[model samples]
Target: MSTVGAQSRGVLRAACRQVGLPDEGAQPIRIAGNAIWRLPGGIVARIGRPDGREIAERELAVARWLTDSGVRTVRPAIADGPVLVDGRPVTFWDELAPHRPGTAADVARLLKQMHQLTPPASLTLPPLEPLTKPTRRIAEAGLLTTDDRRWLQDHVGQLAADFAGLPAGLPAGLPLCALHGDAWDGNVAVDADGTAYLLDLENTCYGPPEWDLVSTAVKHLTTATVTAAAYEDFCSTYGMDVTSWPGYPVLAGIRELRMVTFALQIADEHPHARAEAQHRVDCLRGRKGPRPWTWTAVP
Candidate 1:
């Protein structure tokens, strides 16, 4: 195991003990912005960084709200709240049974359902802040050169200014409601019975529906990761094509910047991530066309 992986395992073990759950037979499922483990007894444990306690709390609250509203989502394992272990916040979830990955259509369908409902009065979801995460990632990317980081910082400033004027150009008819924030095929998982459920509720917030739709559209139009047919299917399923909207370019730009910074944040650990990050940066700087640029997920 890498040094970082071993440290994460140690922390997971300590978190299991703190929550009175056994660490034996725990298997690491994912390691990215967070470390996820499938512990024994049908429990999944997510360990966040020390600074992500607020995110953990919001995720727990979002899960409870979704469950109460009959929205299909991963359920929380413990009712009390997230547990703090070794300064990292840990939240437990019911381990879903082995299942197939969800399709783009499934993502669109679930997002449509989420967008149709109003959040409970008690639930206070923050507005969608597209730049907050990418800005932090650019600032903290250890592998980024001073010049590269400065360039990204400037790009962020420009995007923020552009975003401020986007609302006026956006189409109406869809009421502002709770959004899945990070709605994408990767965030949707299917159960054994072919029922799709949303995962990763950490990004759930009150925002325009376009914020959710742009992720998939950009995948098809800008990155080419998702197929044109799949993009059409997603739009057909959701009854909206955000790419047709006048304000789409602004949202698409912000999404691309987020994707670039997301990969750059983990460039130090994965060679693929580093290459993809640089490729995206070059594309953003207009040195290369965006169509053929492909960003790989870190394995």
Candidate 2:
């Protein structure tokens, strides 16, 4: 294992022990902003950074709220966390196995359901802040040139201004509700019984429903990552074509910037991501056409 992987495993092991759960035979699930481990006894542990306690707590609250609201989402395990272990927040979740990733249509259906409900009064969900992640990623990026960084910073500023002015230009009667800020097919998991469940509750926030719908639309329109048929199914299922919405260009630009910055942020650790990140940056800066540009997650 690499040094960071080993350290993450150590933290996972310690977190399991702290929670009085068996640490042996834990398997890594993902290693992004948080380190996720599938611990023994059908439990999954998510270890967040030391300073991410607020996000961890908010995620836990969202999970509990979603469960109470009868939404099909990943359930929290029987443990007291968002627990502080070694200054990091470790939350446990029930492992959903015998499951496959959901289709784009599945995502649209779940998002539609979520958009229909009012967020609980006690939750104190924050307003959607679209520029935060991408700005942070750009600032932390080591490979970006001074010009590239400046361009991204300016783009972020412009997007923030655009987002602030979105309310006036949105389609009339567009319902505003709590959004699964990063909803996409990849975040939807399907069980053995064909029940689709939403995962990754950390980004839950209040926003226009169109924000959640843009992922699939952009995938089909800009990148070829998702098929046209799947995108059509999503639009049909969700009952709206986000691409045709007046506010789409702004949302899509923000999403694209986020995607590019995300890829660039990890380029130093994942060498394979460097070329794709550069390609995205070039496209964003108008050096190349956006069409046919491929973007992939860090491996």
Model 2 C-alpha lDDT versus the unseen true structure? 0.85
Clashing pairs in 1: none
- Measured with C-alpha atoms, the lDDT of residue 10 in candidate 2 is 85
Best lDDT among the predictions, by candidate number: 1
Over 4 Å off, model 1: 269-272
Candidate 2 per-residue lDDT over residues 54-125, each given as its tens digit: 888888888888878888998889535577777888899999977888999999999988888887778888
Which residue pairs show collisions in model 2? none
Every candidate's CA RMSD: 1.5, 1.5
Candidate 1 overall Cα lDDT vs. reference?
A: 0.86
- Evaluate candidate 2 by giving its C-alpha RMSD to the native, one decimal: 1.5
What TM-score goes with each of the models? 0.95, 0.95
For residues 1-299, write the lDDT of model 1, one tens digit per residue. Answer: 66667778998888788779998988889877788989999999998887788889999888888878788899999877778877788999998888777888999999988888888887789998999999999988887778888999998999999888877776779777899999988899998898999999988888779999999998898878889899889999999999898878888989999888887877765555777778778888877864646666765
What stretches of model 2 exceed 4 Å from their correct place? Answer: none
